[model samples]
Target: MPRIRSSPNSSLPNPNAPPITTTTISTTTIHTNTTVDPAAAAVAGFFNNLLNKIPLPRWAIYTIFACGALLILLICLCICKKCCCKGKKKKRQKKTDEKINLNGVNGKTTTALVQPDVTDVDYGATKEKQRGKFLYSLEYKAAQSELIVGIKQANSLKAMDLGGTSDPYVKVYILPDKSRTCETKVFRNTLNPVFNEQFTFQISKSSLLNSTAVMQVFDFNRFSKHNIIGELRLQLCDVDWNHVIEEWQDLAGPAKFEEENLGEICFSLRYVPTAGKLTVVILEAKNMKSMDIGGSSDPYVKVQLALDKRKWKKRKTSIKKKTLNPYYNESFTFDVSFEQIQRVNLVISVWDHDAMTRNDAMGKIFLGCDASGNQLRHWADMLSNPRRPVAQWHNLLSAEQVNSTLTLKKKIPLASKLPF
Candidate 1:
């Protein structure tokens, strides 16, 4: 249905009237709100400046800084750990010392070789600084050859225990003749112990001029070696013997050693197979080396027995002061099996004591199944007579020579042919 009609609305004749075109104007404004931190900016700027100045890559520089920081942290940790460990050790040591002190105060005995908390320098200084005094009275009766001694008390004695006190006892003896020795009862936990004790010694009037009275203060230890606090020595010749003389004497250290001559020793030996007991008695020593400036010596005996020549057991005798020919009738016993007796060596030695220095060895002697001459004879005698003590005198050899000879190994004899 198409009818051809002229449509005036479709005409394009409005071109001049106002080709009033369409004008579209779009206005848009964007606002940005952001803030920057000054510290972060400064840090970033510093890092950027550093990175720019260095020739290395950023990753390499950052790795180096990280490693340096880690190392610093590790070092700080180690220092802190060491400081903590040191603090702990100090605390533990203090606690142990306090415990020992408490035990000593409670009359309980603690066995130790030495004080673990004290150094040698500090111990020496303490020992030298504090040496106390003792009171004593002496009387000599010329008619009865009796010398009476009284140990009244001690004051301001050195503190030798952890409790800052001492369990003290007194030892009184006559020098040059130590056959008679006396000791007082132990007083516990005290720096001032009063021991009102008396003792008597038998000596002729003629022997007084050559004898000296020696008194020693010692700290008692039940399970270990005792410690000597101090000592006092008085020449009997200087004392007036007619009346009882009482005085307080200041304690002193032992005298230093001087050179003298070599010595000789005599001893006895006995063995019993039934009871496994072997006895050795140290008899006497002669011509001992003088250790003091006053031309006298303080000598002690040490007897040692070697099983298989390597495992050795030893015993010691008391010291005899101011004598060249000293007598020590001390005895020692050992448990030796029947099989072990044949492979044994007995060594007897003499030593000079020095309080300020190491003890000096004067001489020594050894006897065994491998020995010769007098030593062999003595061994044979001891083995031939079981349970009967046989004694003899032997010349002491020099330390160097004896040490060389003792290192020699000899075949152990059979039990059947072991001089028995």
Candidate 2:
């Protein structure tokens, strides 16, 4: 008969816990006297019992022991792999959760949309999760040839600087036509902000049906360049034009570079290296965007030479009334040295006049594509051939985003040899 035995002098592993199962080898408790795994010891005992019953040889018994040991090691390895996989899965989950939870500027927690895996294939380099959200309404009035949008509020914006919160602002434009860009006022520090602002763009019914509304969220920085947070794009024709449609949409990664084709701007460039003067003339814009209450736009040119002070070149064209294709023929001169031209960039912007509100940017081009690629070619060509007027047409771009709004030729440094 198989006899079971227990050690009367042994103490419980935990005094408060119930008794656990242990292996009994004849007259001894194998669990207490040895550190070997209970399951492994049990397997050994089973093998011994089988050998005794069948009268197996010592070498065969040793072979069974080796197989049992290898099985135990395989089990341990499998358990370790499972545990490692589970730990990795939990870590990934935690990171995804952090991306969705946003702490508000006022110490209140904010939230965002479905988090996507950020990788080099995602936004290219940084793993910065996409954030910020806002509520908006859209309506198109065919009778008035207008597209009206109401920007209501924003929430849980991501901070772009060490200050820990961002100064948030909104810029809206009708795609394929950058002749007009409408924007909201900057809300300082607070991630949760109320805008409650309405904007109207004068686009004809035919053009409005094919237009897409591109709204970009940006962090306003006083001393540095404003950073783009995210963008929301929607086809204007897809919305029900007859009624006001309001929805809370999450800001998505900006994809403005492809086919946004926001029309074009044409201007002339003449650089006189002898006089150290760069003269830029805004001739007119073809297929421009319209921004107005009056079926047409009151457009003007805004020029700025990004210099040491970043001070405005302090020159702009008078507002031309009621036309998408506004003819300015306005000339602006910059007193710049040949060397200064390489380091400096020109920001030529067209804006819509609004007496009641801040003027809205229609579209922009830069002498250096580093800013906006719209006018980089004209600037490069003028420098390539000295003492000659270089005129060209530039495709208007929305601005910088997850994807650049324009395809720009690299800004080659002016021929190292100065024209002078």
Please provide, for model 2 over 101-169, each residue's C-alpha lDDT reduced to its tens digit, 9 standing for 90 to 100. 543233432322233334425664333343767789898787898888888887877777677788877
Looking at candidate 2, the ten consecutive residues that score lowest on lDDT are: 401-410
Give the poorly placed runs of model 2, Cα more than 4 Å off.
1-130, 256-420
Q: Residues 1-420, candidate 1, lDDT per residue (tens digit)?
A: 333444345456665574434445556678999999999999999989978999998899889999999999999999999999999999999999999788667432443344443566678756655788889999998888999889999999999999899998887777775555556777879999999888788889889889988888888764334678988888999998767999987787654531224766778899998998999999887877777889987889888887666535789999887788999898999988787788888888888887798998888777878554356667878989999998877666666545655663445455585543
Candidate 1: segments with Cα more than 4 A from true spot = 1-129, 256-420
Give the TM-scores of the predictions, in the order they appear. Answer: 0.37, 0.36
TM-score of model 1 vs. true structure: 0.37
- For residue 336, model 1's alpha carbon misses the true position, in angstroms, by 26
